[model samples]
Each structure stands twice: as structure tokens, then as C-alpha cells.
Target: MKTFLILSFFALAVSALPLEESERINGENGWYLPQEDGSFEWVDMDVAEKWMEAQEQLESRGLTTVPVKFYLYTSSNPTKGTKITTTTNSIDASNFNAANPTRFVIHGWTQSYTASMNKDICSAWLSRGDYNVIVVDWSRARSVDYATSVMAVGATGKKVAAMINFLQSNYGMSLDNLYVIGHSLGAHVAGYAGKNTNGQVHTIVGLDPALPLFSYNKPNKRLNANDAWYVESIQTNGGSLGFLKPIGKGAFYPNGGQSQPGCGWDLTGSCSHGRSTIYYAEAVSVDNFGSIKCGDYQDAVSKECGSTYSGVRMGADTNAYMVDGDFYVPVNSEAPFGMIN
Candidate 1:
């Protein structure tokens, strides 16, 4: 029965394939479907029902607003978090010192404040230095189909921008000291937040931004280089669940940006997709995985990049933004995966 449901879902999804040229622009080539071995294959579609379904789900509304919550985690209170809202005095009462660097971590679909990605990343930043780490919870908007959640990204991002603006107005937090990181769908949410901000956020790190409905989305609808002063995208499951084409100023294709080293035979593409966050978490505290500049995505996939000499470092290092380039970084199949030399 479970297998039947799964097959039925895919069948429905498959039937909805190949968006119209008038509706979407970037994926004129074709649609890529996930394979059992964590790879993707281009497929053709004859129907527009699924696309219409997505449109109807969003009702053609410009911005699909949804409820959002924020949690503050600081070195003073690592495990326990203080809930923050625009109306409450939480920010002033909590350890939210605007004088310190502030980082906002947003989770992807089906994720909550307790998601491991949030905990791991929040803990990582706290371990590195004294900073205000806030986890954005948009789960109320995510308990739906992927298409609907995709539609809600812009509205959710506006709320995030409002929160940042609130902090700036009340707590005097400068956008210069702010950094936002998000994974998958949340990556796009981070992008939306950056776009809606009063001024550009200092940096934004997108962990394998979702590919499905966003593949052909306009710059404002998805994470792009212009989302922040320094935007970086780490592609782990590219051409599958993650975006294949680089969208940020600095794009890192670790292990060709497809199937990761440790995620063997990832059927759902979750392992490879999730690795972006783990790699980033490790990069924050452990190593600054190094990478060599690539001429293009093809060069990275073919391993044509010579070596890591005079290369750039990947992960939470703010200094990496000094140069803009696409890079190919090798990763180990185990923990401490940052191939830092």
C-alpha cells in the first residue's frame, strides 16, 4: 500500500511535467527527474495539469503569506531557546546583543525549529564565536504539498525581512553584521528575505537551493547573486532536488555537486541534499574545505580542475567572498569531510 501510494504520487507528479515556455523561462531544455541511484534524467511531459495545479494552489497571488516564528540561541543559552516575535519584548530580554554578529538560520520544507539542521548550524555558530543565532520557523506554511510551500516563499521572506528590520529599528542591529543561511526550500526563503530587506544583508549561504518549481523562476522568486552583498550557493544534489545551474556570486560544486561521496544510492536525494548543511556545519567549526576554481559546471563534473593550489576555501569563512568564481571541491566520504589541506 505504501509503495502503491508512492507510485501514485510520482505518477501524478510525472503527469504534471514539462512546464510551458510562457509560464517558466529557465528550464526550456527539459525537466529532470530523480533516479533511484541519486541521479537525474531528462524527461518530456505532455500535460499542463500539474503546473496549473501549482498555479491554482497559489491562486496567482503575488505573495503567498504564511505564519512564521523566530527562536534565539546564544552562547549564554545554547540548548534552550528564547522565542522572539515582533510584538514581544523577547529580543530585549534574551541574549540578543546587537553588538555581536547576528545569524539567521532558516530550515527547508517539512522542517521545524527542532530540525537537526537548525540545531547543528546554530550550535556551530555559537561554538565559533559570540553571536546571536536565530532560527526561523515557517513550519506552519510547510505542512502542505511542495508546490504550495514553494508559492509561500516570498511572503514568508517578507516576514523575515520585517523581523530583521524590527531588530534594526529597536535593537540597533546592523545589516552589516547579519548573515542568513538556508537549505533547500529554506534557501529560497533566505533569498526572499534578503531581497525584501531594507538594505542588502551582509551574506547569504544557500544550501542546495530547491530545483523543482524554482528551476525557471525569476531572480526575485529564487536565490540569486544579488540577494545579498555576498551570496554563495553550495550545490550537493544538483540536477535532482537541488538547482544545477549556479545562482550566486560564488558557487561551490563539491564532488561535482551531484551525488555526494558518502551518500551512496540515495533514492530520495535527501542524503546528498542534506549533506550541504552538514558540510556547512562542519566548515563552521572544524575545517575550511578548500576548492579549485572551475571554468564551468562541466569542468567541475569532469574533474578537469587541476588542484587546490591558490584555491578558495568553502564553508562559513566570510573571507571567501573576496573573489567571485565557481569552484570544485573534493569531499571525503566520512566525517570531517572538509578536504582542507
Candidate 2:
């Protein structure tokens, strides 16, 4: 009887501990906002701007508008929550409306500061093109040795949930038509956000999602998809920074799981572990690779034993697909006939 009682007590005690205590620590090296004293702040707008500017410069070159919002959070208070600016002139999502305009949510790895800053720049550029953007900042610990082991991916996951709840409860925006983009470790953070939303997100684009530490190796409960139907698509180029394939069940790698030609261990060179938007856009464009066509060739030596090799032959003739006209219009009468890029 005493043994049974002791066992029961032990089990209860184990169960009482927070689930975070049991899971493996993930995203320890992630960024966070530093406090005034250079410790750690929940959200930092100053640092975020740097990341945002880099993204804006890249998007500007292509003349594509990318709406974004930057949210920052402290490491110690992952659930403390942060504010989101909207078109309604209100931080409250309830006041948001369809006519108010659509917004994109961008998150950073571990820390929300960098993500928020990046989103701000992206949003500024996109807003110039008339798209409203918002950043969802939440608290998350800074990347440190001890923090890495004790921190849980769930910490960021919970913050994402809070952001979604705010959107749903306050704004009427449907999860569908919502798009999310994350870079590096931010990719896994975005994945967790998408998973907890229960299929509300229409598309999720992971740019070189962090490997090994925070990947899709775990079971596919709600975080993974088998095809483009559920999660739309997962595009990767020069991934595998630390983890190995298959990152997820349906994770797509156009480069055959190999880093780009010039990528190196230090992440310099061609790979550089940068965004794959250009590569992704290229893969989808039929003009770049020609339409998929199949050609059959039987073994000449052994006609009895037939073998076929499918090939995609180009449509012949270079320069046949060149366009001769400029592709830009003035944003306003003040700037007449302005170039897009």
C-alpha cells in the first residue's frame, strides 16, 4: 500500500511540472531585444530596423511590394504580448475591417525585435504601394547557453497563438488568404505559429528554415503538410545549415538537397543562407526552364529490354522570348513614367 501511494505521489509530481520542462530546448541561439542595460529586452524597435532595411533593399530591386509588420518581445516574458498597428488607426484588431486592408505578419527567431524591425522596413516599402502591414512582436529569451537548454519552442509557439487570437477575436480577417514568411530560425517559429492556428494560414514560405535544432523531424501533428494543398508549399534553396533531410514530409528542395554551387561552411559565397524568393520565383516560371516535356528512347543495344528516359527539351531558339518594352508606370503624376525597379 505504501509503495503504491509513493508511486502515485511521484507520478503526480512529475505531471505537475510544466510541459516546457520536459521538452528539448530549441532556438537557444535565437535573437532577442537587449534591455537598456544591454541585458535583454522584450521588444526593441531600434535593432529591428536594420534587418527590415536589408529586406527592403532586396525587394526594391525587383519592384515587388512586400507588406510586413515587426513585433518585438523580451526573452523573459514570452507571453507578455506586444502591440500591432493596423489600418483602422487602432492597435485593436477588432476595429480592423476588410476595407481596412490586408496585413502580413513577420516573426524573427527567438527574439521578436529583429523580426519586428525587418517587418517595419518591409511594411514601409509595401505601404508605399498601398498595402497595410503589421508586425506581431512577442517576448522570447535571448540566445544563450543556459537559456538554450531551458527554453522551449513552445515559448514562441504560444506567442504566435496570442497574435492569431488577437487577429481572430479583434479583426475579422480569415486565416485563409493570410501569408507568412520567415527566415533562418524564424522559419521554425513561423511553422509553429501556422500549426497552432489550425489551418488558418493560406500559405507559409520558409526561407532557408533552420535545421537540426528546430526542424520538421518531429511527428506531423498539425505543423507539417504532405502537399501544397494543406500548407500550399514549402520552398527551400541552399538549406541544411545544421539539420539533415527530410526536414519535413513534403519539404521541397529544388537543388536536390545540396547547397548552392558556391556555398561554404562559413555561410559566405553563393549560398550565404539568404532568402530564396528569387530562386523560388524562377523555379515557378515556365520561361526559365521550359515546359515539362517527356521524350522516350529505347535501349539501342537491347530492344527486347526497353528503357525510357524522360527529358525536357527547350522550345528552341534563344532571344525568341525576349521582351522589348519597359514594364513600369508612375506611382503618381508627380513622378511621370518612373521605372519599376
Candidate 3:
């Protein structure tokens, strides 16, 4: 009887653990570190080792499990309770409405649930639609190496998939009404989540997915058309921080995909790169940004996307097409970036 009781206790303990043990990277050198000023600094073995030690110390209280948080927001109370919480078991699924669509918003590197584009996304969705918005905040897992975050997000994706499975099993959630929106590195994370799920995520919208070390990577390594039923990639800064190649069913190249207007001749591409999420956020509220189907970027630059001049809407109202293609739109210097004139 004692042995059986111990076994039951062990199982309970295992079930209570967080999603950390699955994040193991094989043959990774772990030498990359992101700078505070949006640059990168290569590290020696000692520095990398110390960084790893510090990260380990932070997560030591939970043994091998790392903390990942999910914040729930709906139209009833759109603007509160965004604090990081690990109490997944206590989630009042009452905050959710199965009749409405659910959107999982994942953020990029060094981003928090309350900060960065996740906040904009959550607010825009709540205001625009009667939807269930889940902001995934993994600020607890800190890694200096960008490669390590990349690898770790792969594991995180599987855990997210498991969460999807749970919702489906318990609350009768529909995969067809589910969508994932991610920016930069979070874009790839969304892909991994869709890949791990039971193959019916409605769509994944990637806002300028990170380009460094991920542009030419394998399909499974980064996000691709196969990640979801429909994938839309909006590239604001191409051939630099954002992916150059069109990696989705509908690839949007605002102002020919690079060097946005009114950036004040910026070379760092920071303003241009960040415009993707801005455009997406705007689209959520208003998807009237006239997007034209283009054969190539040159066609967009020359104001020519085939003989027909009719342009299609690009963001939340885009036509869900299964075929692959490139798209274009004119740009201005400020808010309401996508323009027809």
C-alpha cells in the first residue's frame, strides 16, 4: 500500500512540474548574445558559461522545469490582469468563449508579456473582435545566446501544442477557429506550435520573422507555408533583419519589402523592421490597407502589379488563398503606413 501511494505521489509531482525538461539543445555552442542597443556580441566560453550559470540559478527552485506564463484577456475585461502567473490549473476558462475565435499571441526575443508588440496585439484584438486572446509570456526563461532561445522556443512550441490539445479535450475548442500571431523570433515559435498541433490551426501571421541565422534554414527549423493551413508573412525590412524570401502563402512586401518611407534615412533598419508589427496592429483594427498582387517587388516599386489595377486588402481581411505568391503595397512615413495614394 505504501509503495502504491508513493507511485501516485510521484505521478502527481510529475504532473505539477512546469514545461522545462523538454527544452534540450544538442551540439549547440551557445556563443551568441543580444546587446541592449539591438546589436549582437559574440562571447568566449567563460562568458557563455557564466551566463548559463546565472540562468540556471534563476530557475533552480523548480528543479528541471522552466516557467512559461499564459495571460488570458477577453472583450469583457480587455485591459487588465496581464501579470505573469504560472497557475495554469486555476485558469478560469470562463474568461474564454468557445463561440468566439481564440488568438495566441507570442512575442519575440527579450520581450515580455506586458511589454513589446504583445500588448498592442492583445488590445487591438479585444477592441476589434469578440475574441479570446492569450498572450504567452516566457520572460522567466532568460538566455544570453540567441541560438539557445531559438532552440528553446522549439520545445516551448510543443508545450503550447499540448496546451491546445488540453483546451480541445476539456472545453471542446475548435482548431478551425484558432489562430497564432507572432513577430520576429516569435514567428518561428508560432510555426513550431502549429507543427506540433493536430494539424488544423486556421492561420499563422508572421510579422517580419527574424532573418539572421533563420533565412535559409530548413522548413522545420523556421516558419514556412506548411506550418499552418494559411500563413501570411509581412516583410517590412528585407535582406537585413527580416526574411528576404517570401515564406508564406501570401508574402506582403510593404514598399517593395525594405527601406520604409519617412524613416528619416535610417540605416540601422530599426524603424523599418519594427513597422511590420505596427502595420499588423493597424490591420487588426482596420484592414483597408490596399495590397496589390505583384509578380515581383519591381512591379510594386513601379506601381505595376499586372494589368489590372484593383488591389486586395492585406491583413485581417485578406483572402485566404492556398496558392503561394508575393504581394505589395505603397507606404508613407508614419501611422497608417499602408496607402493607396
**TM-score for all predictions?**
0.85, 0.46, 0.77
Rank by lDDT (best first): 1, 3, 2
User: How many clashing residue pairs appear in each of the predictions shown?
Assistant: 0, 22, 0
- TM-score of structure candidate 2: 0.46
The sequence of per-residue lDDT tens digits that candidate 2 reaches over residues 1-341 is 22443344334434433224234232232223222233432212222333334433444474332223444222222323344543344444322343333434444344454443343334333433333344444343333321231123434544565565566666665665454555545555556667666456655545455443332434331234432123322233333342223333223332332343234453321243442333333322222322211121111111222222112111111211231111111111121201122
Candidate closest to the true structure, highest TM-score? 1
Cα misplacement distance, residue 224 of candidate 3 (Å)? 0.7
RMSD, every candidate, angstroms: 5.2, 17.2, 10.8
- The residue ranges of model 3 lying beyond 4 angstroms of the native Cα positions read 1-34, 40-66, 82-89, 140-144, 215-217, 297-310, 321-323
lDDT of 1 by residue, 155-229 (tens): 788889999989888878999879999998889999989988888899999999988666444676689989899
lDDT of each: 0.79, 0.36, 0.68
Could you give candidate 3's per-residue lDDT for residues 118-197 as a string of tens digits?
77878888877798788887652354435446545666676677777777766677888788888877888888898998
Q: Which runs of model 2 end up more than 4 angstroms from their true locations?
A: 1-130, 138-141, 145-152, 215-217, 220-223, 226-229, 232-239, 242-250, 261-271, 277-341
Off by over 4 Å in 1: 1-65
Kindly indicate the candidate among 2 and 3 with the higher TM-score. Answer: 3
